[model samples]
Target: MIRRHDVTPAQFAALAAGYGGPETIEALARAQLSKHLLLIKFIAEAWVGARAHRDAAVETLTRAQAAAPAEVAELLGSPLVGAWAADCTRRLRGGLRAEIPLDAECNHLSAIAAAAAALAGVEARLEVPSFGGRVAVPGFGLTKLDGAAVATVACGRVTVAGAAQWLAPRTLSATSHGRSIRVTLDDVDPYRGGHHVPPTGRLTSVDGWQAVFAEAWDLLATHAPARADELAAGLRTLIPLQQVDSHSARSATIRDAFGAFGLTMPSRATDLAVTLVHEFQHSKLSGLLDVTRLSDPGATELHFAPWRIDPRPVSGLLQGVYAFLGIADLWRRLLPVVAEAPQEYAVVREQVRWGLTSLEGSGALTEAGRRFTSGMRAVFDDMAADRVPPELVRRAERKLRGTHDAWQRRHQTTDSPARP
Candidate 1:
């Protein structure tokens, strides 16, 4: 097991400042805590809403049951919490109409209860049963989902059963980049719930993903060791890496969660390496945002996003810039490593130039957005002076700006700003 260290705010600030170095495992672990806390906080909010409705229901039930004293009171006493919890689960499910399993429902409530107890800053002596209950949040402490002692906030402890230990039936460890991380072959996402869900695609069997993961890691370790090392240092887990059998490679990266999200492993190692670095950046920023807010909370208006075909909110725009920082950084570094592969080198070089151009058109950010992005300012500025042909740089700039303008013309609304 890796030794856990206390991650400081200053460390996160430096990351937000855009310093180039491998992200310490401790820091990544802290960011993971922020994600769990945020998820817990969300459930707590839902629980509070559910309780409001439940209290009224309970009062009405009590009045009706008053006709029969002993039997009715016993019924009420036993099922009160369970009934309220069920109602809260329904409310939390929202408009999604699907047959949710009973275990899933109970687990959902348990998660919320844990979060609520933590938020209340009180001791939670609740034992929650779950498929895999592992709530290990850095600084906040560890909780197991399985055992009777599910959570103890007073002592900062949580016990999660199946979920924590069950990444995949088949798992492997790879530390080629100087740090160890678990690669899971399962297709089911452990973090699936809330607004997050599994993506649609052909699932890669254990054997398929294992082979793909091997190829991907080999490429990273060989061609982009530095980038690989950075990822190893920061990304401690990979899970439910399902394969999408598509004609072309495609991937999705989510912040606030570790591991790839239905991310397709590309055929080319270079592509895989670049994709890993790109998505990992999103994961890093998500963790950072858990502790620090970059965009104004009130800036809810959607705006044109250069990288995306659709208009995005302030949060999306900020995420785009931050993610592109890593994208550019990867290609900038890889360009030198792939010198022998002229075709690949040229592609990396263009990607770096285009990423910079895209970042520039990312529109106006809030004060925090600007400050947070300041850390990356030097990196982008350095890439600006790269020896790429002036025409290639100009072409990339025009293409990116043109795409943004076109998207705005097609989708911009009265409330939507001209730029993000």
Candidate 2:
């Protein structure tokens, strides 16, 4: 059965303000679950309509749901599953062929069912997709069977013929001031791609990743407890990407895959914390956009975003504004404790201020989007008022001007105006 999710006016305002509490995060999660459920239903119906092979995976999933409703629901709510379902539906809708055989793609449902059955302690036999001799049980670990494609789940154990290796799921944790954050280091799922980078299959060792994640969590919990609580509630899966350099990492969030971050390993805990907060803000806005109409579906206008090299659409501009708003708040809270916070806050405050200006002038925003931007403006106004050293403030202004000039020069030949 499909469930209806709603955001009250007060909840909407709080979320738009960029500091929605944990409860709002939970509500957004529920809304995402509902969306995933609808997508799964669409996939099933489309497959049947196409006269595709009928697999027993759906039946197995139904059995698991009956036996352990809560556990099964949690498994189905996984972001990887959401990604798979969305991709399959899109391919089917567009009459596009999947990279894998349709039957193999259909078997992904079986893998999900097998994982659910194992969680529920139900015996089940199913043939799941195998990628390069690896079978990934969604929401769990991966089992390598060299050439095997079928998986058997019995007594809460997953096994396949000629199994040669097993990699348990990795998770990292950190706590401070009676608050803790735990997240799965998901490096094994085949469908974990589309996070803006190819998934790095499995890590040789998670020790380094664990240390950095723990330090990052501690930083958030100690200084930004509210954001920490939000992380504990909303951040679930971290998809590791290949590091770009010793000091830099690339990270992105998928609109369809809420609660999952695809990121390279950061050398510093501060970088990791900021990345988590920034990506999670994107996730929150994505979820809100799902339930509400924030922008006109037909409106098309590009605007200058100080953070990006090219002009961005109104929707993209709004996303940047919201993300930097969170970063600005993070640095604002860390100002007294961390020496670099003032400089960091000044930089993001300027970027966000520029983005908000672009968004406010955009003709693409719906009434709800306008209200949301206003809430963000109120938050930014507070952060902008924070006293930074005169030198740092001057530095930020100079940087903004330099970026704007560079952007204008780059887009001068284009039809769209360089500034909003």
Candidate 3:
């Protein structure tokens, strides 16, 4: 049976104020997991009725479920599994073309079942997907095979014939002041593709990632304990993106793939911390959106966003406001300690203020959206009283106006300014 998920008024307010506790995150996760499971069920039923020859995979998964229900459920709960299932469902529904052969596409479930059986110590042999001599076991690592597409699980061991190497799952962990953060450095999953950029194929050494993540976690745990806790509870995987440059990094979060983000390696831990807080805000809001609709879907009005050169829809504006609110909060906590905190705080806080102003005047907000924005306004009002240097505030205002003028000149329109 599928479970119905609801967000209470208080929880909605807390989440809107950018303060979702672990419990709230877990609730969102449960809702996402349910959506994935329903997709899987729909795919299975459709495949069976159409005689898609997917029974072997279904049988394997059923046996695994009977032997170890929790293990099977856990395997299915992965974000990549959801991505794969969503892809398969789309293909079956004619929304997407069949890129791979139907049988090969359906075999991903067999791969998942094989992983679950291996985890549960159930003996089984199954045909799974092999890409360039590597067979990935979801939730685990990859096993290198010469040319085999079959996986055999016996006596608590999973092996592909003539396998020469095993790449165990790698994770980065750090602990500071009783707070701990651990996340998988996932570079092997083929389904980790929704984040615009492809994953950086398996890393030779995770030493660099480990050191950077530790430093980043220390900063977060020491200063932003609330976000640290949120990360600890919700974040599961980090797909490494190709490095763009020494000082800058790009990151993104997909709406369907909860708890995972694609991020390039940044040179400084401070940048990584800021990126983490910023991207995870997107993740939180994405998860919340899955359970509830905050904006009118039919609304088409576009407004200037302080961070972007182009106009954004009301939904995009809401997402930016929530994300930059977290960024501003992080910088606010780092003030006077980090060398760049003062200017960063002033800039982002001004951006947040600009976004909130636009959002308040937007006519596209639904009832829920209005309440959510009201909660955000309350938080911003509280933070508005926090002191920033007079010089920095002036500089921020100048930059804001300069950006607005540039946008106007480029777009060739004089819409109302996004600022007060």
Candidate 4:
């Protein structure tokens, strides 16, 4: 479990009053911060004790989730409780942390009982559940596929049966027993991150993602003729080659970001596409290290997207993030053949068509141009020679030529000595 601090009673009462609204978020956060926080709050509030806190506290938590990600509903203490509150609102039997990290990168899961042991200042290891590729064991028939832990949180019991919601670019899943709840999430962004994706089909060694990539790319090519240029530009940046996933573009959160990547899609397809793009971008960027930084981490950053602020001025930082999103968006929009390649999987075909219709016109993503234009130019040199439109290709060139004038106008560094 990721360790954290505690919360105070006064803090709990102060923030608990505002449970489910954006009034405080709107006022406290910048426009960019506010937009992403809305999504964070939506998912976070759905997790266990979120409902107990005041709207302000939840809003504060949401903001922290987005900007101060290092501190989500961590072990911060709230005096009103016996021990400390993981969150101001999440008052467990004794206000303790329930999450435990299972893997090196903190991508695995462990039970709460174990977490409490460590939290009680006992420093014990928790026994976590296991499911690797839903294998057919000696006695068992079938099981879950292999993947990292996608959801982990603490709370009083919530819904009986775990309700899975894949709203797109956003998702919410909460399972409660009696007094506690475990709500896992992705996000719904004005310009938000798509996260916590489930497997669409499978990506084992044999019937792996590589095959899925070629087929999905071909299918998407037919519908998104306008995106072809963007697609080609993105493809040229990859290192080894693009490898798409089985049941390509079938993840839950990706559904909402279909339009942003320039794809006309249904819900399910969009979801899968969104995730595939993210993974694919990661793969490709690794291939293109010499290419540019316009491309960033598709896996680490996008895999668990927190929330995105939507302020116009903050677009500069947003631009850095959008560059990667643009690549994933393209990947999602372009992969549709997982369904048709019956030669590989028949059910996948049906699922693809079904999802495309479900996630229609969810949202359009702006090209995070400011940051990537340079990166794009650097990596796509092949396109640079002829693939890129002349005017577009000349962009960085012009900027470089006018560097002196630009520096005089915008450089903020001071040359004068400081006076005490």
Q: Please, what is the TM-score per model?
A: 0.61, 0.95, 0.93, 0.22
Report the lDDT tens digits of candidate 2 across residue range 116-224.
8898888888877786667878866787766646778899877877776768678888888899877889888877778555778679899999898888888998889
lDDT of 3 at 299: 94
lDDT of 1 by residue, 209-252 (tens): 55666666776776667656666555543434334445756665
Best by TM-score: 2
The clash count for each model shown is 21, 0, 0, 60
Q: lDDT tens string, model 4, 1-420?
A: 122222233322222221112232212112222223333333344434223222333433333344434322222210001011112123222343333211210111122222222233232222223334222111011234344222222232111112233222211121112111111121121112223432222112322223334334444445433333233322211111122344433222222221122111223433333443443333222222212222233312111011222212222222323334333234333335333222212222222222221112112212322223333323323221323234432553443324423433444423111110
**Which residue pairs clash within candidate 3?**
none
Over 76-129, each residue of candidate 3 has an lDDT whose tens digit, in order, gives 777778778888888888888855666566677777877878877788788777
* Model 4 lDDT, full chain set: 0.26
lDDT, model 4, position 124: 25
True-structure RMSD for candidate 4: 21.2
Top-lDDT structure, candidate number: 3
Show where candidate 2 strays beyond 4 Å.
48-54, 95-98, 146-148, 245-247, 413-420
List ranges where model 4 is wrong by over 4 Å.
Answer: 1-271, 278-376, 380-420
Q: Is candidate 3 or candidate 4 better by TM-score?
A: 3
lDDT of each: 0.49, 0.82, 0.83, 0.26
Instruction: List the candidate numbers ranked by TM-score, top first.
Output: 2, 3, 1, 4
